[model samples]
Target: MSATENGWQPAPDLPPPSSSVGIIGWIRQNLFSSPLNIFLTVVGLYIIYKAGVPILDWVFWSADFSGEDQSACTSGGACWVFVGQRLSFFIYGFYPESEYWRINVLFVLLAVLIIPQMIPAFPHKKWLGWFFLVGFPIVSYVLLLGGSFSLPHVETEKWGGLMLTLVISFVGIVFALPLGTLLALGRRSDMPVIRAICVGFIELWRGVPLISVLFMASVMLPLFLSEGAHFNKLLRALIGIVMFQSAYMAEVVRGGLQAIPKGQYEAAAALGLGYWRSMGLVILPQALKLVIPGIVNTFIALFKDTTLVLIIGLLDILASVQAAITDPAWSAVAAEGYVFTAVAFWIFCFGMSRYSQGLERRLDTGHKKR
Candidate 1:
């Protein structure tokens, strides 16, 4: 006989106690799980109260948001009026004001091409991928460089500010990954000459400081090039950045490759796959997945390091802010200007980081599941 039928009338399915679930439960579990945790939590809260309140007040409340000039700024809080006035220069730098719509169009086109490619369920992905890889470059080049179809030529020298920064970073990241993958493969090659060459190349680039590379590319190398053989300064900087960053990326990719099980390589061999086919079809996908965080970390570093272009006389976003802050009218806005740049960098880097985490979770391959 069942207990319920025997008059045991199961206690009316009581709800869980309030202390076991909700905000109170979370607080208890995380902050008061032990005496040490409780003490640490109290100390942490005190620190936040002491530091965060003033920072928040300065960053948001007392700051001068909308204004014409420094005259609108008070002694209290930040002088964001300077940032407000020069916002356009921060974004577009010296790009022609009338041609702003071209850049906007490029951005729209990029989102159209890239968003679809990023989504797995999207149709025509193969077409979109080809278009992004092949067609978009041509379109973007023609649009930005603009000597065709009645669009006036905008010289590369005029490119500066955040626009310049993004261009350099985008080019570096796009070119670096594939070049690095090749270098990593070469490093692990069976031939002594190829392995030695890749190792030497990676070590040579990694040993030098980035500033030195930029200096040689921008200032010194021009003197050595044949007379009348002109090269764009931005292009030179790009080459050096690609070469340097690829070394780091190669190391990251190699780490991922090394992490793959030996059985994977043997399995591919047993399937009668050639070396290149095995790597492309079986090994590389798993290897790249394992090192998503490292790759993203390198990307973030490259983004920030774009600021170093200031040394080569290229005015990246940080340089633009520095130039604006140096103006006599906005002389006191150095702190606010730097803060704005910091926030801008943070947004892009944080976005990459969060995206990497999501990608890792999505491509987890059952390794992290029970």
Candidate 2:
């Protein structure tokens, strides 16, 4: 056996595997593996070149950025000048010019609080979370709607644009989440009365269109209330949006709750945890994490639906855009106005989507088979 007669010999050390394995292999496997794939890749490249080039030209090369009026748009391309002219209106609506600093401060405070909360690695998150949830809203309200401070009182009717849209969506989501979770739990309760009430509330709101709900809040709600009990229009709209969205959220949360295994509940109970403790400490955390995508989707939908407030005479971003384009100077450039509005909405919605994806990845505990 020691004789070199045995033909078995180690293969010569292959040259170190090529570094092309990183990107080149990936391209080969994904884009150019088969003849059909190669053809498709070429076709895709052609399509991109054809479509993307013109879009780039229009947005960058041909678009008008300067000048005060439509006459500045000489390039037979998009008249972005109109957007620039009415930018303030698009952002702040008819918010009083003198009080613009208050809005700016509110935005700064929001960013200061919210950015840290979104980042998981930030320290003292619990305290930050409490402040963001409990304190920020009070400060924001006082700043925006001043009656006590020497700051002049700006009527709710004066609130419009992106600010109003954000106010509605943010307040709606903040209130709806807890309410929805409770409704979901109640709907699954052992007690008949609580379950029945929860079921009815969810179904009633879910059955009606949001437009109808807003209409009821705007017109019918005022009629039902005592004449002396004057409700702010913005408050009425917020209530309607919260109620409408909470029903949808309850259903989404319920789906997540139902997806949990019975063993989880049994295990919690066996650990001597009472109902509230078991659900709050064990069940809800997992349930909510499991449905992060659904929850974020509901939030995105609610944000977009803020535009419907315009129907009730509340000027959200879309309403502000509409108002801006109504000016004869910018009427012809409605497309530009709408595109700006769409981009703004897209930024917020896309940010939410990316955050949800990151959260889902982080919370994934390998409970399910990959």
Candidate 3:
């Protein structure tokens, strides 16, 4: 049927250009938009292929998983048997085998308390969060240290591996954030004495390396305590981590506080809000939102830095891995131990990073233009 001959010619429709739709279009626009980009993309893919393939091969394709010991790993692949055999030690350190149930109980309790707070549909999240932050530590202390209710007292020296790592990081994070916020506020106070005290504390702590601070806490801190006071190694390290990290956290928070516009303060004051109310109800929420990335970054660094506790005789997860590799039977499997340690750390840190990103997206508002 020839439309032209019918005197009612129909206009033809054509498909959109293949270069402007679908995955191919995305690749064209994002990866090959220019000649330089095309070159870089090609190079990047080549690099990934060269590095990733062998890593995957070593990790899974040729790796030993089901073996009970290193002898079972003879395929020239990663000897994951070493990690498997010592997995409990890596998790709970020298804590008594019979008490493994205690650690599991703590893990279950943590998830029960935390998951509800994360779910948006859950009610009274605020109260739960407060309880988790304040009460859970006490509960954990009783369970882990086991001094109360006739439970055998597990000394501080008995704690190590991932349990110790999590303890230090969690307590440091819980205490540091609030303390740091207060320090930031004090630093910005109108009273010169209060401001000077905060400035001194922040500068003093920030000036020293965390390594030195840890060393001091381990060796020298005991001299100043009252006579007969029993200060445990883990306790000292916890105190050091909090104070040291608080200094850095204060700065991160202060940067956020400064970014806030002056008009917000005036608005808070106009509503008859006092200083604490103004800061807590209005200023802090905005300031904290703006610096979510920095706060999370500090936390990530602190989590990794817990590895340094090995210096003061604390066998954190990395230290536990190091200990595992020292065994004569598993000496050749050091790489596997390290890879396991790395994967464990990466999982936790990546979770925190992603969660912080989601929080930032949820809180970030009003500043973007339409």
Candidate 4:
């Protein structure tokens, strides 16, 4: 039969590859497909030009870089000179000028510990927990706080800015997670007394405002302790944050534990595994895996919530930015200070969410056909 005869159709003509792909096609589809898109393209270009060109010119071409004072930044751009001059205080606060290397080393160690947990080929899961949760914290505390072992002492009061934010969030997570897990397990347990106590603790914390908790930690906590007992202000705040975060973490983990099927537990029991063994081996591994997204989300929230340290008179990164802006030298740059903080927070939170997505994809093999 002819190509166009006997119900046979001729091959449809194809567009040239260059026209069908790459920049021209992308522009046609995204920027000018409809009247609204065309309008948006024009509006977006105008906005970018208005905002971007001045910013780039001011920050790079017009702004000063090498001066110790805001006097060098005579133009209308970002006074990055202020940042450059005060970079040390921004990072280390009142930390001893000479001992800042301790903080840097501790940060490096944390990065080393965290990097392995992120990789798929790291050591066995149990060993990883032992190293991260048990070993690394001890080492990090000794290196950073430096009260014993002849390392120079840096008081927690001297901690400020981003370093303080990291310390608060890290300590909060480390202390809260195991406590949360135990609460979740107890909430699900058959022991009535334990279940009641766990429920009360979780509910009590969840019911109050975190700010109020911080206030109590700052003001009321000292009254509860012995008269002579001393607690660092930062330590008190960390305790409050952990207690508050643990309640939320408990709920997240509880959801995962409840979503688990009963048969999995029964099967573990049939295998003669005891309570902790069955939960640890057969149940929690699956449950925690299922809830990793939720756990990471809670963690991200806690990281942002560290900004609440401002109410307790601590200079976490957000408060530090506030302090930087209020300085008469940089008062005009409040917007920029906030924008910078938002950008830093966005980068960290966005990276965590992306990592969580990657983990979800990696662990999605259960539903695939063998």
Candidate 5:
């Protein structure tokens, strides 16, 4: 009778045992779960502290923020004053300071359009895309060049700094993607002539280093033209970049296309859709989604490669920084300039990486219930 009345059910599970339930438990399970892990954690923390403290002190506490020259940097820390002094040059290069507003306007417009396009919830994406792909280029060309619209003419040669870097990368990406897609398609085409041409073109460019391609474009290209014929150096560089990059891009895209299941093609054909329609509607969307990371990697590489334009005499941001550091007053702060440039590049590349990851997550149709 006593046993029948005492039904307590083992104290209702006892709150998961204290050792496995709280903050201390979490730390034990994660950081110091094993002797090796504990040792590694301690060593890593010690290294970070030793390396980080001096860096933090140099970058923040002891840095010269409001000084005019190297004399102000006597504290054995970064001379941010050099960065402040030549910040304009690092950003705008030789572009006339009076017309900096033009670049500002372009930047503002890009932010307005691009920020929205990046947002998944934003409406009117199709219209925004049309404007971005077509209208914006025309408007930018008019605003930047300006000989036809009563605005002062600013030659392409005058473009430099971050502005030129952005221009070349943006143009290369915009033009390369579609051209690469076409080449990828042509490479896989049933038509012998198209396949041969595509293969030859891709092989020729992919076989050469970008430096060689740029040299050929800049040096050999002019020789092939008539004696009086002239081409813009920036344009020549852009052409070489597009040609070189598109070959790589085509390979990336072709890999994506090949990863796609043949069943998809068969399904689209079963629906009576033609080759272009099937690709545009079903195949490409999926293929492109699968290769988002590859495409982003290519883009990051292209962005960094813009620095190579310096070899051909275009003053990109890196070149501008180099030029600024040569000034006797700031030459001692070359490290600071380089660090700033590296940080800028890191920010842009990191942003692209984060965006690609987000896009991949969003487009992940293959995920299943875990």
Candidate 6:
């Protein structure tokens, strides 16, 4: 026996504990204890070499980058130069080459509006509501779609490819958010009629698929209109997407509302805050913050769903790629077109998800600290 300050310690009469006795020892005893591990290691290395070597060779070592046309790419490897040649058309679609700068400016403005909102240090969060929620869209529409002032009118029919996809997704998120908030409030309203109406609206839309909604917009929408009534196809799709996505947005917001403790409501009531005041000042800010990640994910899903517009005959990015490949001159390069589209989609989606993760961290505020 050994004596210590706090208590008696075990006597050092037994052999010292071996380092390789727990997890490391167990691994050595089973995995590397015999000839099987060495054999498996060798087999794994061989498989890696067999698969990776040829792929690395074909993708980069033997790939063609300087070809004038697909015919010049005879190296039995990828021909990425085709993408470089027609990249602008793929991104901007039928948007006039001369007016491509307007799209560029519009994208920059969106980045400016969104990026500042993501940062916690921005001085005027409320101002962003007016600017991004209201001003930017009007400016972008006037600048890109043109017509209102002296700007040349660019018909919505002319919009296609990635530009149309961006437009559709942007409009969906822009409209869905405010609409969702109202729906959430309505669902939680004190009045039975308002609550029932909001619940029915949310559930009905949520029950139906987005494709069905798009179909209704594409087919049934025109029939319901008065004579001589004309609607833009893009606008119709935008409306459908907004309506479908808003239901989902409402549910996400409702989840956030449910997460708020009753103590918060009680405290707000004790402060003599009215319903709207209590909700806006206390409940929504916290609830919305808690659900930011979910909302961003919904937006991402809506962005991807924009591709489904191809089924209804709208030429978004995916349809544009399909159109490109169907051209006889580019038939052999279909794989390249699809790959280019996939890469572009991956870029946009990955960037959005990363931004959402950042927002989650920024707004956590000890509620969900890692």
Best of the candidates, lDDT: 3
lDDT tens string, model 6, 1-370? Answer: 3477669787669653564688867767666777989688678779979998876776688877886776878887777777766777778888877888888998888888777776778889879867886888788789888887777888777788888888888888889998999999899888999999999999999999899999999888888899899787887888889989999999999989988888999999999999989999999999998998999899889998899999998889899888877777654777778878988899889988998998777777776433
Q: Which pairs clash (backbone N, Cα, C closer than 3 Å) in model 1?
A: none
- Model 1 — which ten-residue stretch has the worst lDDT? 361-370
Q: Model 6 compared with the native: what TM-score?
A: 0.84
lDDT score of residue 357 within candidate 1: 80
After best superposition, candidate 3 residue 138: deviation in angstroms? 1.4
Residue-wise lDDT of candidate 1 within 97-188, one digit each (tens)? 99988888977887898687457789998789677756877787898889999999999888777778878887887789899999999998
| Clash pairs for candidate 5 | none
Could you say which candidate leads in TM-score?
Answer: 5
The TM-score values for the models, in the order shown, are: 0.86, 0.86, 0.89, 0.87, 0.90, 0.84
lDDT of 4 at 304: 92
Q: Which lDDT tens digits does candidate 3 get at residues 130-162? A: 888888988898999997898888887888889
Please give the distance, in angstroms, between residue 57's alpha carbon in candidate 4 and its true position after superposition: 4.8
lDDT of 2: 0.89
lDDT of each: 0.87, 0.89, 0.89, 0.84, 0.88, 0.85
Worst 10 residues of 4 by lDDT: 361-370
Candidate 5, residue 298: how far the Cα is off, in Å? 1.8
Question: On residues 22-121, what C-alpha lDDT tens digit does candidate 5 reach at each position?
Answer: 9988988988999999998999899889998889999999888887777777877899988988888888888888889999999999999889867999
Query: Which residue runs of candidate 1 sit more than 4 Å off their true CA positions?
Result: 1-22, 33-35, 117-120, 126-130, 259-293, 366-370
Please give, for residues 1-370, the per-residue lDDT of candidate 2 as tens digits: 8545697777678764564377877888889989999999999999989998888787788999999997899897788988888888877888899999999998998888878858899999778867876788888789888886898888889998999998999899888989999999999999999999999999999999999999999988889888799898999999999999999999999988987899999999999999999999999988987887889999999999999999999989999888888887654787788889999999999998888888778877877445
In order, how many clashes per candidate?
0, 0, 0, 0, 0, 0
